[model samples]
Target: MPHLTCTEACGPDELQRLLRPRSDVVVEEPDHSTPEDAPPDAPAPEAAFRAVDGPFHHYRRTVHVLERHDEECLVRQRISYRLSVPVWGWFITPLANRELRRPRHDGTQPFWAPAERLDPRAGQVLGVLCLLSVVAGYLGTLLSQTITFAFDEFDAGLATQGNTLAAVRVGVLIALALVVLADRRGRR
Candidate 1:
């Protein structure tokens, strides 16, 4: 996403020039001005509002004037949100992000640039690496968690299992050493 999205021209004042206030949220209060202590050049929020109620109660909307050239001031609006509800947040967060990232009400175009497709060869390599990582992770998890069960089947003692686990840890360190060597070699 772009560092900041621009808004339409100012309504009447500096704060009004930021992102159009969200219709979905009930602002805690209309804090329409920057704090007095803020430096004049600082991109301090021209407007800041927190949602007073609902699942999006944690939403904090801030608008900053990045560049001001008479009537054509560049405004950047940021909406930080997280649902307070426990189970509902998992579902709502993604949906909210998708909705918020694009122009919701206004006819204006989305400021976010769409992602370009990866090269076919790069995509194939990524897929193979992802699959390999999953397999490796599963093998590691299974080995650590089920070592006792495996030893029980072999009729081995606790001391043997401890020694075996210690050996496996040392093997992992050896593998890590090889990875370090490979990384240094690849750089050349």
Candidate 2:
């Protein structure tokens, strides 16, 4: 027979064991505590929140676990009663069931991308490319101008004179603005 123990302050392993066999577990209320500041309308957090943390099958009510470590966990759940359609890659993209930050209706498990800290390589690359593009555009403008002046009116150089470093500068600025906006959106 398997037995269980709930220490005064239970750890993750202890909690896992408790959840293993039982679908639901109620934590005993802590006694002898007075609140320094308590909301009149809101119930005590311990009493109000029934935290169900384990290997969960997602559903309408389930929140997806965004980040999880040995002890710390970050979960994201859909905002109920709001069906928002997020746009991705220049098109309206509907998220798959796995992409949703919620539990599935079925009791099947789904694979997830484990959370790892982001590195700075992507930022470094984008900065380098922007610089290079600016330089290239400047050089192209100077070349096109010189060619137009030296060549005949009907020459190809005359046609490409509109393509200048100024154009490149405009394009680069637009791209940078887009990148910054995207980053801001991600942070929120």
- RMSD of every candidate to native, in Å, equals 16.2, 16.4
Write candidate 2's Cα lDDT for 9-94 as tens digits.
34456433322222221111222343344457633322112223321111122123444577754433321111121112112112
- Residue ranges of candidate 2 with Cα displaced over 4 Å: 1-160, 163-170
Model 1, 168: alpha-carbon shift in Å?
A: 52
Question: Global CA lDDT of candidate 1, please?
Answer: 0.56
Q: Stretches of candidate 1 above 4 Å error?
A: 1-20, 25-28, 31-43, 102-188
Worst 10 residues of 1 by lDDT: 109-118
TM-score of the candidate numbered 1? 0.37
lDDT digits (tens) for residues 1-188 of candidate 1: 11224454443464452344543322234456554545799765767765553344345667777667755666677666654434334544565566554433432323331132223233345446666778888998898899889999999999998898899899889999998999899889
Query: CA lDDT, every prediction?
Result: 0.56, 0.36
